[model samples]
Target: MKKKAFKEILKYVRVIVFFAVITILVEAVNYVMVQPGYARYIIHTVDNPDDGSDYDCIVVGASHGRASIDPHYFLEMEYAVNPINMCIQGATVIDNYYMIREACNNNDVKKIILELDYQYWNKNLKRDSDFGDLLVYGQLPFTSLKMEYIVSQLMDKDFRTIYFRRYAFAKNWKTAKKYMAIKKTDEYKNFQIEGVAGIETEGPYQGLGFFYRTKVTDKKGKLNPSPWTYDDLNPKVQKYFQKIVKYCKDNGIELICVTTPIPPSSVVSGAANEADTYFKQICDENNVRYIDGNLIKNEILNVSDDDFSDWEGHMNGELAEQFSEILTEILMKEDNSEYFYSGYDECIEAIKVRGNETKVLKYIRAAVFIAVIAGLVKCIDFAMMPSGYIRYIIHAAGNPGTEEGYDCIILGASHGRSSINPKHMIKSGYAKNPLSLCIPGESVVNSYYILKEACRNNAVKKVVLEMDYQYWTNDEARDSEFGDLFEYVQLPMSKVKLEYIRDELIDKDFRTVYFKKLAYTSDFSKVKYNIKTKLTKEYRDYDISAVKVCDANGPYMGRGFFYRENNNDHKCDFLVQEWTEDDISRKVIKYFQKIVDYCKDNHIEMVCITEPITPTAVVKGPSRDANTFFKDICSNNNVRYIDFTLLKNDVFDITDNDFCDWEGHMYGEAAERFSGIMSEVLANGNEEYFYDSYKAKIDEIERKKS
Candidate 1:
């Protein structure tokens, strides 16, 4: 018995070891392939300073501060403060806290200048910490702080973002090969700033984290600032802000929060006043110094729209020098009120708000700005979303309902999609209107929504629910947040969709919802093609031919069915995944029950059907029990349960050649035959249509064939 138990344990041990080795190998490849970027430069600069000297002040924030403040100017102007700009692009308040801790640990830093970019702290903005953490994590030293950051922030992100940092770049071999070659170089290995900066074409990398861009903003370009409101403060960002304050206070470091100056063109008339009021209120409560560059008088720091590099408020090289000088004076002066206006209104008047625009005109500008942003977001949604059947199914109007109410609708995964054709059922005169809504790899959860969507739009009299046994054993198919995104984006806005978003997508990765491009594997070369196609008449018209002609399957025949041609030489030669009772998912069952309940409540008849499979693919497992489980649920619910796998050999015989592949997805000729047979069985509703069990049916098929 001991020896038998040891052998049993050995089998499990081998499986665990196999997966562990795969995990390690994948991680190792990701580490080698990840392309070095901006994070490496900034982290390396602080880790290995050119002079190897400590600084008196460290500037921490996002790109606005990085380009606005030149630390070298503080030294050149003969100030006692020796400063280094530690402001990283896209750094959040959480990132700021870690950066301060890292800088304080490495050097004798006496003060921290926290640059305030309202975009990071605004409640309404869609900020992604997962993507933000990815930029900083790879360059961090192997210390407790690094481990803590990984545990806190990165643990929730997609593992691909954590390990494969250059996920987007991996699409192009030219880009991938370039990075791989760069990784082998001595400069990259040594963390040399020159070598890192040389690989990309951006602005000149001034030492101490100061980046200088020469390109100036077009004076005619609109410069709209991200909106700010008291109620819109992000609590998580506020928490980290307080942490930074406490960290500075405990260490006897002077902490000043500064909102760097923007071009006059970007300022909405009274926007700065409200922002400054909130900043001062928060600063007073914390006993921290606050400075608003927008409030600075024009005489003290004369900046124009031409001074800015872009409408978003990043400064050109010339503007940075002027701004840095003004920054120095603010540090030097005992009372800096001498150099500034009372508030934003005073500053706008001083700067001359483009032909002295009235309050009504300012509101108009704000309205126009919002409209442009909304339009851009819609364009981005179109560009990023990949063209596929899911998009076609969701967008197409005549999908099993809408035109005329469907007498019956088929819903399931790829197996049902390829096997059953609604046209065949309609031609058999069993139903007036019937269509298939099955999509490839669709889960029960997805099917529920599709049913809801169909019912919401038009009268759906009956729903044919295809029961794929494999989905019950696979958690990914049952409840993958990433998998849901593909359907989620294409779904038309409705109460059902709103509930779907709340229940399914609310806490998932923001990238999955906002960055639609990241949901699937996309070739960068096709981005132009995707954008262009979206603008075409065919796409806007929801022409089925766009997908039918382009689909990998033979063609989309219609009503959510893709007809794959029969391969004469192909044979089904795979085994079904064996599972025990424990392998079944409660979530899958819950959604399955929901579908049944929904149909009943709506006064519609619902039938559960298991599509036939090749006899060779049957295995000794809980498949029998699984089939009986569904049969019991349908029986208890007063819904018809038909396992076509147990259908009489006289009704229909399925051979390995009937299927296109080992997975039992039927080819075109086979699908039509099965569809005709299924129509007859449903029309008759006879108990004599199916055999006693799946095993008995398989045995009968083999006995008859032999």
Candidate 2:
């Protein structure tokens, strides 16, 4: 009996072991099959159509890099250089060091152009922590050590959807069906460049002149460049920067550091000078070559702020092409031996021939292969997944629909999205039909195309653009999700836009996109879904009474309602304050003019209004100054301007406590009161040109309110 029991126990143990092995094998197979394609997508996406390598020269930094360099111009000169811009908005030197390291490992990068701007060395611990260091690693083995980030990448719907859909088995069935619905017209398949340059037109820069500003410094408390120092430079960060240089030198890769030209604003603050000094010192110590474009006043002065979409110091695509031509001439004369690649020229020629012939076939084959795999996968799990949610998500995320009909489309940075209330305008009668075609953190270059696409729908009548102060300053923030907006736009620019975009927007590294997706993917659900719901709830019960209003003199002293002022400076934190009088005035005028031009050209009526603020916090300074500037802009443009800074007594009482978040925006009861005021404005018939049937909608809304 004992022998029989022992034998049975051994048999059970064997069964358990066999099941474990089978599970591991199945998981391994799935991972191996899916991973290679995803990796390939990340690697191949950055390859230049002319040559299958990383960009010939990459610009790595923060916002300066994004605004400064253009890649197409380099391509136009036949320099065999592609600029893979890997700059992150608000990025630090530490962030760049890792990005450069990872990019080198993943691609056959030949040269690196580091944008040594003053801000790059400003290492804010909070900013670094928020940006994280994982984005730099790309597909290197050490990346997985950050397991939390890896899990986040796995959960990101955008990253996963984009990655999987590109795979042979996970293509979106509806998208595939739509493609099939459109009958092919050409007998011969058109060879198209998928890696870059989707459609080409005249570059946007051509005859459009550039405007330059002189850097001025004031003796008062304010400095031209607010803060300019490498105070944030610590030992570890400097070590990493040095490591990048050393790695390139040992690996036979040429490292070229270029300080992109600065605007007068930065020059006034002495930031440009400080940045140049630091880069020079680094290059001297490391035996690397450094190009100081910021120091070249004559060259920089020749190109104005108009040459840049952002009006910051950086050049736009057109200027970038010119700058590249200058740099190419210099480099060619200085040192041809450094750039000599063994068999690279021949390889490039061969790639051009093959790329031209197989471009269309490659895309078609990829699509068909993905379709077959998707069919097989569907057969395996047809009953488990729901289809509508994906489509709903796509639509909610601003996928353009077949229906059209929009007048006075708004475009800009996050300010446009956060400040404008579309529903309020619709109910108030200010607009017959208006669409807020704005996304959070969108730049001017990116907005240009989105506006173009909307206009192409033939439903859009006019465009209203909102500008942010940072958009015209060196402090502009970068979006890691889109890599560099400038670079992405350059690939799609008309021939005119292309000249500058290609020369300036393109960068050296393509792997940064994949790495960024991996790093940010971990919190994909939180970023894409949770914030919307949270923002809605937090704004639901904002109390205006809790807010404190101040003017140029400080807090109000009179008997009009007042809130207690806090001793701490947190009131200014994340609150939009005009840093200087000039920042507020210039930005308002610039964008207001753009709006007027768009409306006049499109034959649409335009209205400019300052949305209501909490009564207790309607103080002066930047915010109030901005409102005043808007009034001036409307007067100049012949557009009707409305200021609702002070709410009416009988309609609805709004106190400072009614604000949902901080002083910058209002919500809860305040939103309702503001919405009521909007309704009144629409009923007044002042905006008759916007809609023919506006009276009916106003009547219906007033009736509902009653």
Best by lDDT: 1
Candidate 2: worst-modelled 10 consecutive residues by lDDT: 193-202
lDDT of each candidate versus the true structure: 0.75, 0.47
The TM-score that candidate 2 achieves is: 0.34
Query: Tens-digit lDDT track for model 2 on 288-392?
Result: 887766444332334443454432455556566556566655555575333321332332343344446656887899799768866765442222221211122
lDDT tens digits by residue: candidate 1, 155-241: 878876776655424556666677677777887778765545333344787776787777664643333355678788899888899
Work out how many backbone clashes candidate 2 has: 60
**Candidate no. 1 TM-score:** 0.54
Runs with alpha carbons beyond 4 Å of true place in candidate 1 = 1-53, 72-80, 90-98, 116-196, 199-208, 217-246, 257-313, 318-414, 421-430, 437-610, 614-657, 667-677, 680-706
